[model samples]
Target: MTLSIDNLQQMEIEYIKMFSEVSEDEQTLTFNNSNIPDMYTHNFDLYKSDVGLLEYIESQINKVETKAKGFFRIETYHPISADLIEKLSVKPQICTYDFMGIETRNYINLIGNPECSVLSAESSRVLEDGITVDIAVNEEGMGLDFATRRIKGKAEVYKNPDKAIELFVCYSGDTPIGNIEYIPFNRVAKFEDFDILEDYQRRSFGTSVLKHLLEKAFDNNIEHAYLITDQADTAKEMYKKNGFEKVGEKTELLFLF
Candidate 1:
């Protein structure tokens, strides 16, 4: 079987639906009023070019972002269309990023050479009450101190919110070190919200987190594991070495409000 732009767009939809509040009809995906630093949490997904795209952008600019900035992912089969860019010049902009969508289905021999031993995250425990993520990082370095504490405080908020998301935190004993979030849409696992304690980097934490997460995916009979990463050399090398092959690319439009 082959992947389509629609399938990947829905996965993008699933990504937003997991966190903040969203309402979608046929053409536009609206993430209404989520004040999270995470881009996925507060953004819109335009299926294709249409008048509705302009309307949605205008509406979001006035009612939503004001002078903040308009950052969004516009999923397309190929690179973005020039027609789309011309339509988006209504506002001043900063830059755009095209993410290479990577995937791996049938498991191959595990890939990668780590300087340290590879270890798996603890296990699948509920994000609500059963298991808690308590990764301890330098309060100043990566700002994990704020994010970790905030999410931990809002742990039960998911129950009242709309979607189901799986969050797994890795530990180096009683102290938590790293974590990953997987949102499964139709059999594809979308992995993001990854963080390792500042002091724990380059020590196989990333390798271990991804290894265990994919192992869980395989165990659950998942067909595809999808990742959207920047085109940076280091980011590409790390995931490529971990068996994630560059499959498709996603492009986004950026405008400075």
Candidate 2:
């Protein structure tokens, strides 16, 4: 069965609902998780690109900002106009994510490196270590550090059994160097938080981890696997080479206060 953009969006909404308090109306969907105050969980998704709605969104988010110290994010399926963007009180950073998907059957025979292996992690501790190392390296180059809160929030989400999420840690000869999160719903799998430590990159460990996950999905009769990656990220190239294709795009406007 070919999954359409609508199917992918619905799947994302369902996944978000697993760990958030979700409320929706005609214009927008709001997700709130006070425990996990991360951008992914505490944000508003605008259904329409109407500039008129900005005032209300700003007011609502202002209330959230007063209570917590994190980003105020707005996501839209339709691109917001430049004029609408300029109306914001603070300069916002915009990002676009490619929604990529692939049929798991196509990669059933794909082979990964013999030295690298992926395993389901019962504890989030290993995954947290990998994420901290990755963030330290990336921040050194980018000159920004916000990993503490982000990592803590992710670890909290990973512990939620109700989400039915599996955390996979990639190991190279007993040394953990990477991790990924898998969520299965209705025979479809959503892959997230895929990361490879900076020192271990450029090797084939990333490909190995991906192939291991794809193979596992195929073995379980999963029809398709999808993931969201930043459009500017080079990792999307690797994903394309492994059979995933861009099915859609998610646009977001973010303000960090």
Of candidate 1, the 10-residue stretch with the lowest lDDT total is 112-121
Whole-model Cα lDDT per candidate? Answer: 0.55, 0.74
Off by over 4 Å in 1: 33-40, 45-47, 50-78, 81-108, 111-154, 157-162
Extract clashing residue pairs from model 2.
Answer: none
lDDT of 2 by residue, 123-234 (tens): 5566665566546544654344445555556666677766678778888888878878888888889998788887888787888877877878899999899999999999
Q: If scored against the real structure, what TM-score would every candidate get?
A: 0.67, 0.82
Candidate 1 residue pairs that clash: 93-256
Clashes of each: 1, 0
